[model samples]
Target: MFYLTSGVLFLLVALSAPAYAEQNLLEGGLLLTAAALSVMALALILTLRSLARRNAKLSRQKQSFQRLLAETPGIIAILDKNLLLINASSSLKSLVTEQDHSTLAIPVPLFADANGSIDLLPEIRQQLKQQGIWHGEVWLKNEHHCEAFKISVHNLSSHQGKTSTYILFGQNITKFRQLAAHQQQQQLRDDTTLLPNQLLFIEQVRQAIASCDEHYPSAALLILDFVVASQSEREVRLNEQQILDIATNLKLLVPETLLLARFQHNIFSILVPPHLCKQYNTIFLNQLAHKLIAGFNQVDSQGMRSPLRIYIGISISPNDGDNVDLLLNSALKAANRASEQSDSALCFADSANQQQAPDFLAMEAELYRSAAHGEFDLYFQPKFSISSNRIVGFEALLRWPSPKRGMLPPPTFMPLVEETGLIINLDRLVFRKACQQVSYWQQTGLMRGRLALNISIQHFTQRDFLRYLQDTLTEFELAASLFELELPESIFNHPTIWLRERLHSLERLGFKLILDNFGDGISSITQLRLFPLHGVKLAPALVKYIEQQEQQRNICATLIRLIGYMELDVTATNIETEMQAYLLHVMGCDCQQGHRFSRAVPAEDIGQLLLKENQLLNNQRQLAN
Candidate 1:
């Protein structure tokens, strides 16, 4: 408009000057100059009006932009060329506690590396300058903790023309990050036990193996499983609840520092630290396996009190195999071998054993056939009473007479028996046969007093175990007071409420309970308080160690005194020397059993030995009188 007005004024002045040229040259010149001045004045007025309109429009746009910045959900900021904050939205300012925006010239430490370091600001600025834009996710350190944010920035020229500015926007992504972390956590844990699953366990073992050296020597892998042997290849396995119960009990036995994992339905794995492996030898692991079995035995399977049999396979790193899969395989193979043995219940992996893997299914078939025939025999180990100077009781031990393999010990086929559910039948047969022998002795006046019978946790925990025992005794008309049930120390590992109640019921029903191997595995005096135990059988290890080590002697002495205070009878087992016998007698042991008394013998041989012992006792009594 100013230019148009100026042009029109000049055009009119030029046309009038041509007309006035004839009147006077001087006057025309003055008129032309006045017209030029008027045109200049008009141009100035139009320029001022245009400037006012443009400034009003710019003010309205600034107000709208300010409102948008305030209402935005995320952080919005303007930073100068030096990465200094020129303007920031309220949302951006709310990140900090201070409300003073004046002191906020420099950018906050919101843009960060994955490790939450704010040292990447210079790199971010350089990138923005080179590429005109920068965008990505960054970690931000909040007042209390760190947060995640997706930041975006664009270079812009500032209105002042003094410096360049950056338009920055940041979106909070903390919840997303938390959700991702939770998903990762879920992937590494077991659903039932809430412990780490096999994947994590394998990873831990792999790391331990890789890092193993002279300074950080060895680690051990222990694989535990409950064998369910059947006549067929498809064995009868434990149900989900039974497996869960075993896992729960195992958790109680394992320490918190060690890693435990559920490998399969009835299998669990433990990662033993190098230090522990060095500290504890195979003996300690065998004891641990025994303790685990005892703890597992307390869980009732399908209304039965005895828990399923658990086999532990162990393989030390470097010694067995260095890698995860190889070590796991070796441990599994050793566990299979351990399943064939009854004592200790653990087998360490070795190259020789790995070469000869046994056929468990065939063994299971052989066991079933053996039980079907009357091929199983019972041997008696006499419990000699030091006070009475006679054989007061005998512990009934089972023996399998295999046509193809001669006499098989309990460890040879007992695990298979339990796995095949044949323990229920075999245990009943043993009890009935033992009671018959007792009744014969009482009728013939050959022997007297209680007969102690070893009961498998599997058979003992049966819902009908008590009924079966009562019926067997009644069938023979044997006095319940004359019968004693010897339970291994493993039974005390973790007795459930129901198991505790059943044990008390056994006492009420006239069955005497003897805690066998009292100091072995996880058994302690606490078990004595929890159950209705009439006697305790001191572990053979304690008696043997006492003879060799003074510390062991003191420990045994303290235990004997403790048991004496409880008023429970004590029997020391595995006494092979007169020195051991004399030491036990001085320690106040009521009875002793082992090679010194007699090795387990046939029922007929036991009867003759008892007769000889009774005659000897009578002569000693007469001499004393």
Candidate 2:
């Protein structure tokens, strides 16, 4: 009877919805007795309660599963055979919130290999199919940026049920990678300056040498050592801060193409690429070293100052030596020699050329003896007016005719003279000789233009330089206006109020000052802006390539125009070709000097050039008339 009641209840529930009955079933007496109806109703109530209990248990289980996924830091998902997301962890919502969780399809091409490969997902899936698992790293891009993840994939299938799926887990390792990079940087960088340490510096040199080619012929290494004076308590603290400040300044000053390192305390090294090494001469590098020294002695952020000195030693690859140890030793030796001189603090490593290398003691002795005996002769290089093609003046150059060696250029022996502190004596002799020669020329009616003289900064910085200039001019009975003092732009590297006052004193004495090699130093325009000057001489190499390069021509033209507007005289040197001369003339350059007019001649030969220039002026005047 119980089974019959349960079956009757089941049939009624199933067929009642489609039954087209006019009367109510409970009211009808033909199909049921009172007891049978009661049994069917009881069975229906029991079935409904069981269904509600099962649903409640399933809802609670789902909530617990979601809570676990939400707390997890990584991503977990199940995918079908077509790589459609069957279910995803709550953590994935942070990356793609608007994605349809019920059916999310990600193509294989969407995943990029973290190792910079083009495709990774297709191969990973194939490996999973064969090996039942795959593990690797990949990159995923969302709306903002890409992130790296370590991914693990597992293949799952049931023998009884033919359903198959993949289990995927992803762990974010971006911070771990960054920590590794930070540790590596700490190992390779200096603690104080944050520049590359000595070991890394040597490694860079080795790599540069290994990569050298015909097109890239050489690389240069410059090691700078500083001489710091005794400092007070406040200055000592500032000194520590200065290291970091100077490092930051140098990084900004040097181009990205070069490598700068802090080899040791107060000693920095720079690696010059082949192109720059070939382009810049030793003199320019010396100017760079001086600029850095000036920077070193500057007041720190706390306004505390210290006395500092810098010397630089240079070595070039395939010339000084190709090996790292040899280069380091050679540069350090040169630096040691440089630290003893005032005229210059830059030295090149000794080369293998025996003819050029002389014993230091013997050379110093010879230089001192030669200075005492006045063995130096002056050579003159004539300057000419650009538009008129007339000789304007001559620059007196010093030449040493050594008795032991044939005529030696300044580069061959100036450092030795400077080291012996005999350069000041040499300068005095040159000054007196130049004044006497100019006086003689004027007396003989051989020359009429001003005479230009070259004076080293070491000599010019003397305490009584002004008094010596006055005395020299009086002794020769020559007026100050007839002489133009040619000072290199490098003099302005050490900016000081005292230096400015000295320059003003010279100008007050009626001497015409000319800034020589105007564009060679780091502070060319800044020098011009800071001080009063009579004239500017453009760098010779810069003028040489003006016509060949349009960019160079434009730069020259712009500079010339700006200087002309300042009402200052402009002179361009190394005008070798007629095209260069014509271009300068068109650009309104005031004067020029080059082989086009004449090479540097002797004092006696100057009369001939003056005579020729006078005749040319006469011809032009006659033609104009």
Q: Give the TM-score of candidate 1.
A: 0.53
As a TM-score, model 2 comes out at: 0.48
RMSD (Cα, Å) for all candidates, in order, is: 16.5, 15.1
Please provide, for model 1 over 1-625, each residue's C-alpha lDDT reduced to its tens digit, 9 standing for 90 to 100. 4544555666566666776563565555566667777887888999999999999989989887787778887878888787777777776676643574633686657646556545667788778767777888877665654667898988775433334877889888889899997787789887777778888888999988887777557888889978554445345778777777778887889877778898877789998877666532443454455567677666454676553567888888787888888889999998888877763266779654333224444566678887888679998888888767778788888999887788978877775575557888898889988888888888887665688888888877788998998888888997788888988775654456876888888888898898888776677787787778899888877998777899999999999999999989898988899899989899899788889879999987866797787788789889999
Off by over 4 Å in 1: 1-202, 207-318, 322-349, 359-361, 418-421, 618-625
Estimate, for each residue in 541-594, the C-alpha lDDT of model 2 and write its tens digit. 668788779998998899888888777888888779889988988998868888
CA displacement after TM-score superposition, residue 308 of candidate 2 (Å): 35
- Candidate 2 off by > 4 Å: 1-351, 359-363, 415-421, 618-625
